[model samples]
Target: MTTGVERLFDELGHFNRFQACLYFAAIFQAISCGIHYLASVFLVETPTFLCDGPSNITHVLYKNHSSSSLEEIWTHYKPGDGPVVVQTSKGDQWELSPCSKALRLNVINFQYDFFGNKTMESCGSFLYDHSEVEQSIVTDWDLVCEKEWLAKLTQPTFMLGVLIGALVFGDAADRIGRRPILMATSLCQFIFGVTAAFTENYYLFVVMRFLLAMVSSGYLVVVFVYVTEFTGIKVRTWTSMHVHAAFAVGIMVVALVGYLVRVWWIYQIILTLSTSPFLLYCWKFPETPFYLMAKGQYKEAQELLDTMAYFNSLPSTLKVSQLKDENDRALLKDTKKHLETEKRLSILDMFGSLKMAGRSATCWAIWFIGSLGYYVFSLGSVNLGGNQYINLFLAGAVEIPSYLIGCFAMDRVGRKKTCAPALLLAGVACILIIVLPQDNDLLAIFLSMTGKFAIAIAFGLIYLYTCELYPTIIRSLAVGSGSMMCRVGSVVAPFCVYLADIWIYLPQLIVGILAFIIGILTMLLPETLGEPLTSTLEEAEALGSKPYTKNAAVDRLEMKQSIKA
Candidate 1:
């Protein structure tokens, strides 16, 4: 009997196909970006702000807690007044504000013993449970808008989650299979997102946000890995570029929704919860063919290749035995001895031999700064000082044309030259925005638009460029590491916005300068537009074979040889 994979491969033949499969980023980012995390950032709590105060009492400690039954807890009489005196077991007396304005009017006081466990018992809000009471405290305050220092507290940490996720999740993807991780994250994302939406306690919300961000890490890296593996080399670059552009599209899409749905928390619920469908459906998509090959699931890989061949309307070749799943077993079984001999992969491997530490460092710096500046400008869509969604939509619109131009020019002029100037000029555009008067709306918009345009171009070029620079063996790892660097920029992006409130443009200027320096440094690298992908770092450096060095005479001569093969 034919196996399941073989049958699946037969059915896949009817689908549209290219030299390689193209899983557009538009499919991922547009769906994922709607999270309130991307849109309404205002709900994030600030922990530093002092809440227990005389005037602030009117704002409600918990909310709607009127208690006449606290008479037993009171010693210094207050039949109707808001303030009362309560006596402690140690014979000390203190004047305390009544729970009249608090949401939990029936709250019972509790004390802890030396080991720091709850020792004394108390009854709180007879009508409400502990969860409800905690919820009351959560919903009761607007710490940041109220100028509470605690509000500033949450902002710093919100970013830390993104950073930690970027690093930790890279390992997570490696240790666990992609399917399990992606599915687990999707379930957790939905749960945490819901918890975050309704959570009344500030700390609880913060915890959820961190969890949400942490799971988000592998999502980015995995999507690229998936798309890159499934696609043919001819269309891979353009498709990868589309994935990031999908993120931008997501930003714009969510910004518009955020504009319409002004209730920040409600918006968060919508963004996070809405994408559940996409993730659920994504579960059905096939695993990466290369990942299968590596795992030694050669049969699966063969079946997948047949599916692709069917999709492309090409005849399927090879027997079922030949189509083993490389991944389902040992990826480098033959090389295991060599790996054991070396015991480790070195950073020096990136240089191939000459120790191109300077070049590697410089490239990483460009990757980092390009990430930073790109975010500063792209996310600055929130700062457009008008309809945020409209500005975001318009900013996003600029990319379609810019990408089309890039897709057109990159293959023509080549990679490094085109990418470098785009980055450097993006920096200049950022600086221009600072000097341009905020009141000169037209010039400001123009300069800002130019900055965004450059960022989009630079961002697109980086993905394709990094992939080209690294050879196939370490291609995924190199790109993923560079992506991890982008998370550093992402973590800081929020803090920069916070600082913008104190000194507008200061952050942008810092970001711009960094981008310029790195962009110029990127020019130090070599170009590889038409060359066959080098399979190892050593081959990458040797740089044999000029690409497409076709003479009409040689092409005509090759036509005769083609008949012999």
Candidate 2:
């Protein structure tokens, strides 16, 4: 017998206007999420700044002068003896020092050459460069010097929210329904995101950002499943790939907005409010029939199917009479059994068998490593060898092609072949950066972008592959678990960038090594291309063992039946 999803597809028609509208509507959520997740790039970026210097120096000598004049005075009076100049083959560069002492400024003269010997004292406050950004959280709150670590915590805080949100909302969506949870979270995201833009205190800002992240995670996870269920299997991969491409567009949108708007709060306001329009139109989207069938709400499922058929300009093929009372009772019994089975299942079940345990462990590790590498490149773009705006845009822009390649590879070759090779290439590219001359920024950026591209491809493929690997009952839980690990990876990403303070290559080294090992682990996963989705835990377990044999006669009969339906 055909499954609920199959039946609906037959009636409503795949790639119809109804499904097209649903996919199009859901994609805005992806775009909004992309902008919100990375808004920290512009929100907390530290502009060029130095200590404000002693009040006596500013008020006494430079009180009447402009901010620039005051800054010049500070530079003159303060230590000209900061970093030591080391001559390199490319150019003169300041050698990084562990303990560059501050000299006290005891005397001042307009004619005095700043490089001349002077006593330097610790600066009491700071003056920031306001040319690019008028005010970011870093400048407004002075999140530098001793408070610098606090600025670093913002990215991780949002990630922690995502980690927690995955566990909470993933289970909730599976139990409550995708439509309700999706709507609830989208509203929450708008509320929290907009509130975050107006926050005056850093701690409150963090809290708001955390809430925003928590809600958006639900939107992201549920919407993917929602869209996938509505589309036919033949075109599902393309549809999923386009969702990610929309995310790339969102990334570019943020870059353009940041470039144009310069003020942090205003940028946040625009980005956060942009998603409101989608929320308004979200009511038109339909809940997945698969979800309704799983809950034993066959009547509602049939009505929805009829509605879809109407919208798609097809006949009302799914009538109430078609859902036989006996079949409905049997489905209810199956649903109850599945619910009870789910209650009994735990994380241990993923590892209940040696074979399944290995696969689960490998999938989790690959998710973590791939996500860690991906975020490291994305979050650390400001530190990359180019203009921050251009770097961020390119980082996102390159992903469009990477996602396209991933879609093609998964469709043609198989999940294992596509994911493993992409990850391996990412690892190799990262490691190759160490061999390139740091002075040659062109080559350095090229290699780094190559790594980013490879990682992006791996990320896109793995999400598709992971969903295919799990049974329906535990699908959300499995994907959520992987996303939990993914969030942990993102949490570590900022600190990875911080490692550059000690050694520039340290972060890349960590990401490269982990990716290589996980790439090998990824190869061990069973291939799932052209395979039907498994519905039971037992079926999922058998995937790694025997290859599925196709029955030509059965397929031909089903094809004829589908055509008639």
Candidate 3:
């Protein structure tokens, strides 16, 4: 009795309906990825009324001899009629003209002046400086909890979870199987996600988030490996690009939802809980033919391959044993090595005598720098304007084209050609945003969006490029470590957001320069387009062999005529 997935794969080629479903489901799971920095839109940065209380406001009204009170101005006069009623760091409130609002709120220009003089807020035309505003409003550490700065400790906590999942789960996939581990990760994702949503204290939320992050990484690593392994040499390139593009799409979707939803925890609930059901569907999913073979489950692997061939109506030659490829054999050998070794595999194993260590390490560095800049740029969108949502969406929307263009070019021009230029352009773009006038701001916003476009491509290309360089055995470990570097980057990205308080444009400029340096460093890496996805240590040691030209690959693919054709 062939399983439903087996019957389906019998019709399709190497892809059964179940595996196809998992692929799409996994991509959609990208939505739950940590976009907290962008999604923090509503929880903070909200505006308040200036005449919020009864003291000087009433006195000022009486002194004016007007029946109209300050409260009336707040009700009747919005920011256009007068300055927006914004709460200062202090408990005090103020009514100033819109021009004065900018001047007063220009913490970069004015914070020092107020600090030296002991006053931060100016009282109307006369300067009644309330300098204690920083101490008062910035209650994140104090009001939230004095040691709350430790909340930033979230990244490392999250990283610890990620580190555990990548090493543990990667090894487990060999013994326990890919589909089961993925299913388990998904359930864990749901549990931790729902748990994190309800935490009472900030620390609890952080801890739950850390756990969720680990769960999330497991699914991602498995999905990336599963999808790429089943993909043909021709489609693998584009499929890899799409996986990462899905992540960017996830970020964009979260930003839009945050804009509409406008609450922090609510956004988490949306991200985490909303996707749990897909995991249910995933429970019924089938294993990858490539993965099953790697585990020495040869019979099961053949059944899957034959089933896939039947479903896709591929040439009958694709049946069972016939589906074998050179890469598939290599994958089996690597799995055997991992199994024979003690449960622990050191990071050094990735480099061991491979002479590929230098290349892999550099790839991780690019991963770190790329992620750091991308998220820093993203998180900083808030200060770009209070309308961070629109800016973020626009920045994100631009990635669709960036993804397409990058996938199209990465193989044609080689990884080096595409990656270095993308990073360099992104850096130049950041510098462009910095030079644009900040306050007379439409042009500024436009230029910043342009910069976003550059970084978006840079982000997409890094993952695709990294996949090609390292072999399959440590692909997840290498990529996960790279992704871990990204989380490290995300951790540091918030601190860059902190920089926005002093000189709003400075963080952009600094992140841009960092991006440029990454591009420069990328020149050191070999172009892996037309290269093999190595299956084990020995092949990786030699630097995976270049396999086919992008054009030749494309021609071969076109000749095959896919469904999209």
**Candidate 3 residues 1-565, lDDT tens each?**
1122222233453344544655677777655553433434333332322322324432222212332244443334444443433334443333344233222332333111233222233323221112212111112322222333454455445655665666677677767877887888878777877776566665676677667766677776667766765555445556656776666666677666665664455656776666666765776666876556546676877676656555555654544443344334433544565576534356777677536677777787777777777776666665676466777776667777877888888768887788888888878878878776667566666766666667767677777666666654566567667777776775666677667757888888788888888788778777766664454565555553434322332223222211111
| TM-score of every prediction relative to native | 0.69, 0.83, 0.70
Candidate with maximal lDDT: 2
Tell me how many residue pairs clash in candidate 1: 35
Q: Give all candidates' CA lDDT scores.
A: 0.55, 0.72, 0.58
Model 1 segments more than 4 A misplaced:
1-26, 34-37, 40-140, 145-156, 167-169, 302-320, 323-344, 348-355, 470-480, 535-565
Alpha carbon deviation, residue 339, candidate 2 (Å): 11
Give the distance in Å from residue 33's predicted Cα in candidate 3 to where it truly belongs: 2.3
The sequence of per-residue lDDT tens digits that candidate 1 reaches over residues 117-144 is 2222222212112211122222355443
Order the candidates by lDDT, highest first — what do you get?
2, 3, 1
Task: Compare candidates 2 and 3 on lDDT and give the better one.
Answer: 2
